[model samples]
Target: MRQSPALRILAGTALALLLGVSFTQAASSTKAAAPESSESFDYGTVDSFAGAFLAARTAEADRDYPNAIQFYKKALDFSPNELELQQRLMIALFMNGDFDEGAKLAKLLEKDPAVERVTSVALSFQAIRDGSYAKAMKSLKYEGPNDLDRLMNELLTAWTKVGEGKGKEALKQLQDLKGPSWYSIFTNYNIGAIASVVGDEDGARKAFTETVTDKNGGATAPDTYARAVMALATLEANAGNKQKALDALSAGDELITNFAPFKALRDEIEAGRKPKPVIETAAQGAAGVLFSIGGALNRDGAEDTVMLYLQFSRALDKEAADTLILLGGIAEKAGQPNKAIEFYRQVPETSPMRRISELQLGLTLAETGKVDEARAHLQKLIASDPKDVRSYLAYGSVLSDAKDYAAMAANYDKAVEVIGPAPTRNHWSVFFQRGIAYERLKKWDKAEPDFNKALELNPDQPQVLNYLGYSWVDMNRNLQQGLDMIKKAVELRPDDGYIVDSLGWAYYRMGRFDEAVTELERAIELKAGDATINDHLGDAYWRVGRKLEATFQWKRALASEPEEAQVPAIQAKIEKGLPPIEADAAKVNAEPAAEPKKDDKKT
Candidate 1:
């Protein structure tokens, strides 16, 4: 079953702290190391150490890593003994892509517990790169601040054991490293990878099979699941089980449909060629460790920290399309769409992920206001592969954002045609989107059935329930059923402010002014900055005879950037209160009340 949007967001947030670094240890150590002085670089030549320090801190806060690095260096010149400065500088250097310099500084501060976690991870990567297996193991031996840290320490240590040609010991280490439920996928995948490299096909197959079947691990750590599938496929291919290898690839496709490596291996199998091993060397295995953890952290919204680990992985395996895609995603999340474009552009054209990257690049371009270029790019994709639902979805999404409802509806119509009439549960989104487009175009007759079809395909989808129910209420038809649906939607997605607003608005439409005021107030609290909800609350307040509060809310709505078409009416409401009930009633009685327009924004 598909996870709800709210559930996904909550999961991501919860997982963000899963790999806790010992912040308390770092903080206490930082205080003790603050006052030391060194004679390394002359500082008297510079006028104000305090000013440079403040500027460096400000730059760090602003994420200007380059400037922060420069300023921190200048500050360090004056106070070479300051451990805090070294720690900040090392982080700044790392973020600025000067890993060598960062590692060097980290080595000097290796004994300081405050920066121990960061320093240890950095120095270990350096040692692993230099073929210093013993040194890498030593660096990883230090106690980590959190469960995530401890898990990584053990995993990396196992990889180091493999590096030292102790494959049995490495497997033993992984077998014994107890951790949270989420850690099983990583450990098993690593064990499978190590066994593959050591020619223990049976062991590799058993480990990979367990990893593949782990549902919790698969949902929480999809990249590791994908890797485990690839490892299993490689083992099967080596055993001359061509069909089994193909089946393994198919299974992986269900987790990551566009993974380039899996697609490459599947092609080799189809052509009756022996596929290369998933992990042939200890170095690559170690790189995979970093890549898996980094990908998981990125999903958990720790983009800044994940980027550094991914860079380390990329340095080891430059051709890793997964790492590149992840980096692009991180850049996009950080609001560097142009940087994201560069990363996406770097995906090798032969990779299946390249198509997904192109889609991302097109979307990023549209986000940057290059709508024409985005449209052309997506149109070309559609022309190249008319059967690719993603291309049509991307094109339709761009049109939807641009408020071109007609074009959006037409695009989805094409998608529906491509998908044919035998729509499955997976095709529910297409119907739902088409419904939204038609509804936005004010074609209620066409829109309502599509929504119904979506509900038929995916029963109890809260978004569909909220939208269809709200429409029914707005039109004053099926009032009780509409209210029931809205209530059910609220139950399903209690935290959705838009759905709550719909409930409040339904009450207002029924002229239950007191009830409307109560629900609308709750809705406003839930969606504090929403112009439509605020306006709805204002109308409800006025109906309840709270003229002053109504005017205040109308003014707030005006300031909140309501639709251009809505501005004049809102402004008029603010300047002059709503017309009297007698006049409104007379008008309503003279002309049969037309169905009220529903809000354009969907839940």
Candidate 2:
């Protein structure tokens, strides 16, 4: 809230706390992991400074931090005193986890106010890592990039007090802390953690209760809120209040559906196991201070700053599983799947997050085009625990990415068997995914009932509605009901281009050419340059006699690179046009498709 892209990030820093933004939020990211173009571009061949600078910028945009760092160093070598170049290099270094180099550069730039927010943070992290708590606080001076930055500084400054063994002072600072109402969850949570670290059990419990009960702030930042619940529950468990700990976890579950860490903790407590307190030392408390604000800034376009904060957080507490996992997610978002793999590999095997990290590692491997390796990894994971729906679902996803629908369907079948036919609301996705697999294999009878079952479990799910409705319309059955379902899906996800395209395509199937054209245009607007959507628009244009524009659209579709199997048909449409609009029993060969998703989207 109160921040710029950079200013907002610097101002409002919090931790991913390993509680992570909801997995649901992570699934909704706009930037999907994409394969960065790896054409052999030799930076050494670039003779000019401008050429090197441009190369650095391009690599940075593609999230190729290693190359970006190299190119930027080359650019700075050519123009050593360029202030902006130094600033950019510092950020690139931090994002790549080159903290020593970043620290050196921070010293070089610390006197310049323009880069103060980042430089101050870098310097403070260096001091903290060196165990110079007094120096760390002294280095943490610059404050105003925005309210978020100032608030983060306030929290970090308080943690520095804890580092100096001034625990009571840190608690007092938090008690008097004030900012946006959103700050309450982080503020109170950290107060509790600090108190817990210093052996003030009653004080810790009080602050944590304040955090867990702050539903409004918790709703605003659920990941931070989740961390608060875990902290409070851990405190209770350590104090021998097992039932209280379980109750807290149950409440957290109700707030955050299917969150793995909470479940992991809840199971431990249920089995008469005690969870250690979340914050055990001054440094861990300080790391939470950074994570509390840093993690809140994990949105699109702020990866650079989030990376900086998280790296610094890790420097404070090397065993911070949440910090490491979040860094992996950021790398994935930045289109650096290999870099993500490195972070995932760094997560301690003993941490509760190790399982999730391994799953992510397998997924990231698939993103790097190691499909076979990914399959073997996830398959072994599934074999490790047949009763784990998560393992099966993850395995099925890898197969789906490979377009091995037969295997995907089989994966779900095994999941269904393990689940014992009593599909609950959480199992809706299993049924839905299975239906899609069967649909791809042209087993309509099998696919239909599964789709129906998914809807029965979670009616109003937009993806299910769009797919089933569009299929019915394409087959010329249940025409009105299909159209209504598609329309409802559109209303539910008005901004989703794929659902909109399904509605438009259904209209084309019904021979409502003009209506088809209108809906297709809207779909085109939502998802520009999509080959399938462009092709559909072209077909609608031809049906409505916009012949010239129709040819333009077909050409556009071809340029966007339709699937290789569809290339020949698209070229023929451009050259000879669509077959005369005629009634035929033979269906058009475009297999029914639900909206194709960008993998691992995070919000």
Candidate 3:
């Protein structure tokens, strides 16, 4: 999905060709001049091509992307030597997701001596996207002096070595390129990634810290800082430095308050996934080149190193408001709820995403038992942004948790009022949450209507299916429909022990005792500690006439603290004669089949 610069060039070339064709058509018709004589296309084609190309530009300005793309392609067809058109086409291809074709064109365009350094840099990116790191490095040889490409090339080349699993080689390459440059922060981060790849935790830790500290004041200093902090956190965690890991996690959480670029990296690390290998301090470098060179490292699943790098990235820039919101998210993911709240509070009242962050942080705080504080935050966000539906939803959840049923309903109503009509998934959650509150308040009529509404908005959501089914069963009404609903729920959540148990109970209620045993056994296998499932299995065994086995299961169930009133019935069952059980001769003879895992009790 991430388009590389190469694809951009291809798209640009395609568009330029379209523009050139249009130019030639117009010129040939009006000027009435030339017939082809085996020579290369007439120089007059540039005039026509340039005219049509300009018109295409206007079309692009009007948001007519397809039209623009066509005209640009025509222009290029007339004047293949047009560097500007080629560059534009490439940009278009990347934007349009035609990376493969774009990359091919980029390689051809980069061979042109007329292309500028910036254009060549773009071509380098194309090579990276094409999964040709060696080619990207090769293209950089043509890059002009005193430009950003040299540093970028060095960083990418080193990363390529790392991806090839030659960590020592990568380190040496990186060290060779280390010096005063606009890419210092980025270069250092590459060093850290390389160190971590080679299992040099101490070196990686030091490198990451230096990069994040921003002592060099490089353009990408902030990004490097954030990346370094995050990398260090993950490294500490991986090395069992729990305390330091926690501290680094805390710092990374604080950094997102002002740096948005690093947010995704922070998230990936927090999720126990590796961040993409990035040249942490990127003032400007070829896109996709780093990805290509570090493709192997990226796929190496170095989650710990990536996490540290992400944390460092989180601290890179401190002036952007979006950055702070990113920090809030990182904090929440890293299990620092209080810090998440602190970051969320950094969003000013007028910011659109402020309400969103507030809602998320409030819910997180509430879950962490800071209920009052969470509620206050939600109320504040709602007060400032009364039209925001998410804030209302968060408020309702908080009120529901606090057992304030009336307030919960009011908040949900406010959410519905603000959101008007929307898609099913978006509309259903509020209704479902409100329905739960109504059910808790013992207002069944109100709750049923809301549940029905939720189902109408998003049909067959498993949670709704299960709740409605279980409620009907508990009420001893609509037994057949309840079974159908629970069956549907089970299909949706096949691995859920609780849902499976409900199905078993429904079969038992239908007096299909044999059928009940099958599902009950599966439920027990899924949830070995479930008391209700154990008892249900015992009862089903009894009804199936497996008297001895039934009594034994009942005794086992009783021993596991069965309900007080049920103990007497179990005692009576133990005293009564039991039906015969089939002998497991294989187990008695120490057969190999006896080695089946206990949970495999349910085929």
Candidate 4:
């Protein structure tokens, strides 16, 4: 089973119950007409209790915590004793950074077994804030579920022990931690952090040394290991061993390539600046504990738990940039672009990760359909550091989202100019993206050379191989070599249905009907509900004289929602069947009738 699966289930049936029976349906019925301002629209501006609850759930599902909190409160007022409503409201409040408010609701629900999961965390955090170490320990209890909750409880309890001035005791608790092999990195890192907080420098040094020394641990838990290295390096630097500090950071670099924190810390030590301790308080150490587990919990279906950990970490140390960035990324991936923008905007201006967050903010704005705003924001970023290739990339991404291929090409042209003529393998994406823009603009002469240049820099790149190969096949030239390139792409990315479809489509273009049918069927299995894949399969089936199956596939494509531009053509094919063949397979390839679409579907 997946780690931390039970973490989100702490609230019992609140997730489903709070969401109620009518979320989008009820919420859609309550949408407001045009407001006075062009800047905002309120889905929560509704008339009934059901509407309020539905709006709250719709917002919650979207991760729009601020709006969710407002609507949940409105719903709660209508039915005060609703356990699921109260529990969900608390979660929304916590997620929106109103930790104290969320905790207050948890306080009332503390004795309820169903609400214990949220209460355990909320109450423990409140106790930690109030400096009641014993109360914190008592508040953190959960016997159900897997070991993840138990692990978090123990770590938080250990931090309280550190707060109680039992530093040695905290270290012992961590040393004594028992769980799966995956627990080692977090355990060792916390042990070192507790030791540092207690001023046991030698103990801290030894534990951190051990923590970072586990190269396999570093790979599994790179962020935790990187922090352990920084902490170890700080201990050395403060003790007047500057070279040792540098060495620790150098080791960190080997473990996690180009971590900004390590780079910054190393620069400080090299410039004779004494490094500060990475952990200044027990609370900060506890934050790291959350981050370790929370970072590991980041997966597609586990976002709620991952977000909970990061949000709790923020409650302990509000300005922690790493927590903020991770939270923003989770929001982004969850399709809550507005929520993602809020989190990204919170990363401190002084943070090394500030620029990265800003880039994310711009992309999220575009996702939210604020294309003009995104472009303006990225334009300022690009102008501020004209020589930075990342700034150009961020700007280009906004242009790509806006479908302004000309602007995207211009952006990459500037990136190429900034990098000068000595472009390395690292610069392959710049060439590849520029090539896409040129191809999208129907300038294949320009696009082809850039694709070749990209492959020269990174010969085995699957995307470039697929694009160039597909283009050659579509143009009726270099048939065998083009097919070979596509085959190579499929070999490199066996599970990628898009690449598989390219291979099938290439065979269809060459009139190899049987082979096309086989590959297209595989592509359909891999990428179900893809209109383009279904359409291609339909065409391939028709050529093989499986007319009945071909008709079924065409109807399937229409049901999958082919683009508006493609609907009439698909309908006509279904109505009258494919036109009669004018030539045999070889002749068809020798004189191509039309270019196959390069879009996920072709024209």
Candidate 5:
């Protein structure tokens, strides 16, 4: 083991002690022989000090702090200038909680750098506890072992100020630190608490936001963000924005589930009462932690971080509009439609981001089969902005999804009317959608022109090509041209299951069963579990004389309920089996396979 500098000092003292002992004996003899006025000290003092030092060491070894302190103090009194003895005494006194004596001894021996640096910090903390603010502050000013130690002293100073009922002053001291560390944010939150106590709502809000939003600000915890949210809510409530306040408070409640401050604030808000001052104060403290972490987590994609943020956000703010919207998206991604709805509902109708929030909310609601509510929100959006092409398009899209051809066509017309003469890709989408609405309604005359217009506007758009080609094939008209269009679509979107299915279906319609089988098999690879793709493959297989395989594929497709509109038709097909192909008809007229024995059941 390496020898410490102090240990080296002790080791070198033994030789010096030998010389000193001989000199002291000679001086004492000379004084005793020739001097009458001056008295010589005996070796008794040295023996007594040595005895005390041994007693202190024995006590320290036994972990008896009280006995160690007494023995060390007696040794120090006998040999006051012995640095090592004084050091031991100070340590033992501190260990015994006799900080007053320890601090005094440490100061008296301040020339020792270690004593000055380390002991001063301990002394300062003790001074604060002893109600000597000035002395604590003075002790804190001395240099220390590390930054953490220095920070501890600084924190003690702040505590002293707080004890003196100067909370604002104490907060100011903490707030003055600008370092981007955990401690810095913690200090800012402390400042917020002071500001709140002084009725400085604006100051509190600013501090809270700084802790929460600033990427490098000191605050860093979910609870901190919750506090910031609650603080903001209180400010809004005080300013008469009742709904906004409720939203903010509710959101905070959701974020800070375990914190009492958020719950207290929530209860007050719910009861139409003002938050108590202490609630604000405590929340300010939590805000420091919450904002510091929440801001970072907001961008971190780790599931754990996101989940932590989610849980914390839920605790602090129940109706946090922005957080709710974000959480809603996360919930939807996690396949929790109900949870998503709960979050999306927090976004206010008057919010500038309402359109986006409402759109997501409507979609999630529709996923959960709350179609009426989804449509109502869509209608509200349309009513508010009749010329908003997005609202019209969304409403029309939803209607089309429900297979409500008449309503979808009406919405598509309004979308087209508002988007007249616009030379954009969106215009092409509008035309294409309208054509689909017409086609679904079986208005072939109306569908044809719009489809042609869509093709002209967005040349070679694969979806449009597939739709037009599939329509021609379905009607058994222009088979060659329909096949050509579908082949082009297949080339453009080889992996698109719907387009691939259309290409295969077109081939089947033209009685090119081999080509149909190839495309349908490829479609199944691209879109496994797609009911339509499975159904198309089954038809192609039957046309190619794969009767048993066709039956299996058809059963799989029938089991897959793709959407509400397709469910009934697919179920009906499952009950009745697929339409007879030319190959199947030939087999029926030819011969059947040999019947199995009664004991040899089908595997």
Candidate 6:
């Protein structure tokens, strides 16, 4: 699955919903209403109902699904006809893994015109689980309101057909799916799965081959691509083509190294054991469908919606390590690192992905402020697997975060040693990070070579170009070349304020006051709150005779909170203007005597 950029700019309404602030108004409005009673017991009053609802929303915002469910239920006991409440309750139950109760609520919600696509999907999965094939087919027929929704609906329908024992028909349905070019990889992958489950070895081989060969397969649907490769490898191993099976596993490994299923299959093949079918039963086939779609949705930032699908998938196939990893990732993204750690911990010890999960767990431990534990955990991983460069990198990153540059550099050195002298293009990050570490330690000679090597390996990488260029210009060496490099970096990352500031500061150092003023103004516009950029702009303004503007810029810089060591200097400059330069007295005195001697010779 390809991760999408974060949607940090949530609209006010969405933010309110996520934070449960929307409930506050509703709760306050209901405070004066009367109590209601049930046949068996006395339910809470409207005020109590409002209080429970508010609590539920708060709990939901915090990702405390069980408490949210409890409060939602309490609120529902007072007011059962509230459709919005019903929807919230259903989602909470599903997210809490109480799918049976969620499904029950979903049955009622299916009639709601405003019901979300995820609710419909949950109902369909419930139907499938209960062996109600007709109802499942009906649920699948409800058209989705968007492109992704429609595609998922069609895919789920086809999988439902497979569950109904019409595997050939299921394959036909997938073949007929016409959508965007992005749908091709998923379509081919599911076709391969349905074929494999239906005992059509030749058909399965053909579909899996197409899926593997699809150019967009890796970028758009990596998890599905990896699954296809594993399926193809299993087919080859079954056919007694040991080398071909290994080759298939190698292909999958290139796409996603250390995938547990792929590693397990490779191990079995190497040991002369026949690997199991990738999708053995109809239920697992349904689980695969859910996993693929859910994994994709997870990447697209529909964490809550995807969580329900993955939970259902897990219920169907508990051994799906990829599903577990995706769940953990969702938890991490939701800012529930403890929950993420729990999911990561559930990865089977026999799986190759177990190590990757451990690595993530260590990072998440750090996120929770258990820095020492995270460091120790990652250190143990490095000690156990000395050749695993990732372990070293993870440990190094932890140390880097703690501002321990020396330790970070030493860890990267260990990584370089483990990787041997012949570092591949992929090893560029190791060098880049080590360079950053050395630079932070003020070891310029060591840092410069590492940065140059990083450039050699990954030419024109924006961060490397910007850093190396800025360093050279700051040191008054390679001024023009450094300026050129910084310019190129700005072009590459036009929105990066710091790179733009470097260009401006370079001009200032070269005494191009006017040009510095223009570029520095632009940099300040780009990053108005950056103290260094503000200070640099102030210096340029002062040089250009905009003394008043320079004073204002300096005030802004002071307000922006510069580094502690630099504060006193900026304060001193604000108190008194820059010191005057000494006159070249020798040059001034020698010129007159030379002119006089020339005049005497002429006479």
Top lDDT model: 2
Better of 3 and 5 by TM-score: 5
Q: Which pairs of residues collide in candidate 6?
A: none
Residue-by-residue lDDT tens digits, candidate 4, 363-466: 77877889999899988887876766766776776676666989999999999999898998867778887887888787889988898999999999988888
**What does candidate 5's lDDT look like per residue over 30-77, in tens digits?**
222321211122223434655556656656544455666776677777
RMSD of each: 6.5, 6.4, 25.6, 6.2, 25.5, 11.6
Q: What's the lDDT for candidate 6?
A: 0.73
lDDT of 6 by residue, 146-221 (tens): 5555666777788788878888898898888887666777788888888888888889889888888774555556
Q: List TM-score per model, in order.
A: 0.83, 0.90, 0.42, 0.80, 0.45, 0.79
Candidate 2, residue 74: CA error in Å?
Answer: 2.6
Task: Judge candidate 6 at residue 21 and give its lDDT.
Answer: 21
**Model 1, 1-603: lDDT tens per residue?**
233233244334322332232224333433333212222223334345564565566566555676678778887776788767787888778766688888899889899776777777788878888889998988987464466667777888888888899999999989988866677889999999999889898999999999887766777778778878877887898799999888888877777654556766787778887766646878788888878877665544467667777776765666667778888877776667787788888887755456778777788788789998988999998898787777777787778778788998999999999999798876777888899888888787989899899999998888788788888877777888888888898899787777888888778777788988988898888879888888889989999999999999999999999878778888998988888866643443111111122222110
Error of 5 at 237 (Å): 26
How many clashes does the backbone of model 4 have?
2
CA displacement after TM-score superposition, residue 169 of candidate 2 (Å)? 0.7
Off by over 4 Å in 4: 1-59, 62-79, 141-145, 229-250, 258-278, 382-388, 414-425, 441-446, 449-453, 456-460, 528-531, 546-580, 583-603
Candidate 2, after superposition: displacement of residue 312 in Å?
Answer: 2.1
Off by over 4 Å in 5: 1-323, 478-481, 561-603
What are the per-model numbers of colliding residue pairs? 0, 19, 58, 2, 41, 0
Specify the poorest-scoring 10-residue window by lDDT in model 1.
589-598
lDDT at residue 242 of model 2 (Cα atoms): 91
Global local distance difference test of model 3? 0.57
Per-residue lDDT for 225 in model 1?
85
Residue-by-residue lDDT tens digits, candidate 2, 254-340: 777767677678777788877766678777776776676667666776666677778777767777777888889988887778888
Q: How well does model 5 score by local distance difference test?
A: 0.59
Off by over 4 Å in 6: 1-78, 96-98, 130-135, 144-147, 176-180, 249-278, 297-312, 511-603
- Candidate that beats the other on lDDT, 2 or 6, i.e. the better one: 2
